[model samples]
Target: MDEKVVRYKKNSNDIHVLPPSPYTEVPKPNVRREKLSVENEETIQTKKKLEKTKKNFLFDPRRKTFLGRSSLNWARLAAFYTVFYFCLGMFFVILLYVFALILDREVPTYYNKDSTMAVRTTATVVGMGFRPQPMVDDSLIRVSNDLYEQKRIASSLRLYRDVYLIQKTDAKAEPCTELDPASELVPGTACSFSWFDIVSTQDHPCSDNNMYGFKHEEPCVLVKLNKVYGWTPTKGPLPIHIQGLRNIHNNKSIAKPDVYITCDGTNPSDRDAQTEMVYYSLEKPSGSSKYGVIPNYYFPYRNARDHVQPFVLVQFKNLPLHRLISITCRAWSPGIEHETRGMRGMVAFQLYRSQVAEKLIKDDN
Candidate 1:
């Protein structure tokens, strides 16, 4: 029976499962998926924390922080800038006080004749200005095609009218009987400017009838010297013969120096074309007319209250219609120096007659 049982067991186990093979494969852990799940959880937590921080930034004032800065931090920053600017302002004030100490209050510290600095640097000794300059910020005079254009013509006349009225109404001014070239002008004396003599007649032009010579195509330009305090014109080198004649002619009386004015056309080509152009008072002999452009002794312009500007009237007899003419006027005196760059002691301007009226008339047809 033992032998039979042994045989049955052997036969039954004939298809026996062998022990597990050494080459059998085992399942691997999903490490990549586990790592991704851990990263996602951490990202979610970080996002939640950022949102909470943003909410605190917006709503939580008691948190004592705003956009990563506290209110106390901002206040300290502002206070720092305030103190910095205050110190800067104090420094500027100190600089200004030091500058004031170096300068004179009444007189110019660096511009006077005795100034060593002024001697080293080229200074403007004279200034020239003109009136009846209709356009703002401009010195040129433009006349319209039509003489009676009220807007254009009246604008120029209005300035002259105001000046005329002022001169007429001022009772304190002494009657300027003559603009003597040989006379010495007293500094404080207010001489009469014969406004009527130049602008009163139709023959000479510059009258109400002629609209100050604008209607007649003979416009008047009034030139004035800028005021310089404590400065006087020097006697220029006079011609020897003229000086000898004056010395011989006037024995006892001192020979008075004259401020001569000359107006020339800037265009060398067109200079001959406008030969009729002349200075009204200068056309006559010296001391004959009281209305010279620049009179003798019209210097050392005092304050505005006590002094009137020394002015000359320049009249153009005829101008080329609808054309531009560049003209320059110069003041010659020993005390004044001509400057090439600026309008000192000299002024240049263009005279233009508008062809717009003619263009408009042609366009209408």
Candidate 2:
């Protein structure tokens, strides 16, 4: 055993390494290889899943722009109705203008009438600047049984003539003397026919000594009628008489006499006495000379009060009147005709205004 052991010292490069044995396969890198393969496969599968998720979440620009246009179209439709409502507001403005033109035209009517019988009347509405004609209404004609009497007399008498008288011419006076008896003409001696000579004819008979008697017998009958045309030969005031004479008289003086009339049966001749004939003088309000007589007193009973109704008012006019005070009134009677009398029942009388009658008086003095 000792003799078989031989020791060999190998050089650094001289030792040849034997190749791995083919029968004893190389030790496979089993765990690491398996791990590397599994890791690579898992990475590829995760990348595939990320690509699918990105495709599902995709948004298109064209589809978003289309939706924005649809919203603008809806906004435009809403604005159109607002403009249409503003345009429809003009219809009310035209209607108000038409109503203002109808209120600017009108007329006034007045009816005035006077009658003796009962008749219904109405006023005809006429146009401006013309008087309205009254119409008869037959529904209100009835007379009340109130009868009265009224008398009227002349207030004044006027005359135009020269005065004369019958007298003899004095022989001792101048031959051509003037015999003026309140006459404008002078009678001379050369005057052949005297007033007596011409009036003594048979045609003008002065047989009656009565001053009021008239005989138309002479051509100078007009002269005789003047002297005899006075009132009854009463001792009171003589009636006014005027004569026309061209010749002059010897002693008689011609004078003008004042005339008068009375409603109460009395004669007044003095210049101061004319006041008695005046029933009412505008100067005095009440007294003996003042007659407070209303002109409408002659109306029937029911009609009498009609003039006195409260609706009537009298209005005075004119600054200064001669002898009468003028007053205006508004009448309100319906004037309906009565069934029985076939006449109007009452007349309407309305007084507009009144004042003191003295405003119209003028003193003769």
Candidate 3:
């Protein structure tokens, strides 16, 4: 050994005292593992570089998209919604068309079922009504030539004349007579009501010119019947107390059947007032009838166009004044129902006068 020192070993030979090897085996380079690690580091760097780029939100240039969704994807979503809403709207439109087909045009689907008419299946008949009321709910007529109340009544009557008396349609109407009462109603035609003859007495008796009889101590009241669809009163005899035109003795009068109307006081003193009544628009007797009347041709009102429901003008010559007076009017016909509780087929109004019109009461005494 070349300069070898002898050492006492504790367990084995010391590495510092060991001799170097002459030919050590050289280690092989790890090419596969190094290449794999390099490739992995490159992929990580490339991913980080892509993340740094600003993908435009307005137009994604790399993917040819908008707001991250491709144009084809957006088109598919829009098409789906478009067809969905269109079908929904058309479904409702068809339903509404079907509903419209079941409705009636001229005839009403429902009618008034008031028991007052006595006929339950039919519509309610119109009741009698009046005008010149200061208020609609008020049941009294108070007017005078001297008091300012007459102006209101006059304006109201004028308004009534203009509005309700209007000829709504020009439909051809048939001229009717008592013998041909059925002629008043043709299946397809209207009836002609005499409009000019309503106030055409010997002299404009119950017209607005005489202050409607208020100045002469005679107050005029307008009475009109309510319209009911196709309502015709039955042909019947008159009641015993309802004198109608029976008391009048006129041989020249024609015989015309009619629906009679009468008015009287409910109290005994009211009946004793010596009241004289003149009726305008009373049909001139023209047949086998004995009294003036509302001709039958006016009935079975079909609500025809060009139809103006006629009204009766009553001129009270000696109506009591300065006191509350009660008056009741009734229309008598077999088909008409009279119900006091319902005010059907009848009208009641109170008369109160104390001023200018009352002087007539004094003159008679």
Name the top lDDT candidate. 3
Regions more than 4 Å wrong, model 1: 1-60, 64-124, 147-154, 160-165, 168-194, 197-204, 239-255, 282-293, 354-365
lDDT of 2 by residue, 1-365 (tens): 11232344576445444544446544457898899999999999999988755554353254533333455665887788777766666555556566555543221121123232213434211111100111133211111111110000000000100112223344211111123211222222112212333224333222122110111111000101011110111122222211112132333432322111112211222222212222221112121221212111111112111111111111111212122221111111122112323212212211111232343333311
> Regarding lDDT, does 1 or 3 come out ahead?
3
In order of TM-score, best first, we have 1, 3, 2
lDDT of 1 by residue, 1-365 (tens): 11111223454646443455556665679999999999999999999999998988765677768776788987999899999999999999999999989886545645546655246335436667666776658867876546445247656756655664245455444544335321244434455555554444555555556665577666766666666665555544643333453354432322444565666777885576554654555335222222244555544444324345555677776687767788777776555666668566788877765545677667655
TM-score of each: 0.62, 0.12, 0.60
Q: What is the lDDT of residue 285 in candidate 1?
A: 22
| Candidate 3 positional error at 107, Å | 3.1
Tell me how far the alpha carbon of residue 146 in candidate 2 is from the true structure, in angstroms, after superposition: 96
- Root-mean-square deviation of candidate 1: 8.9
What lDDT does candidate 1 reach at residue 31?
100
Q: Output the lDDT of residue 152, model 1.
A: 71
What local lDDT does model 2 show for residue 101?
59
Give the Cα error of residue 56 in candidate 2, in Å: 5.0
Error of 3 at 269 (Å): 3.9
lDDT comparison, 1 vs 2, better candidate: 1
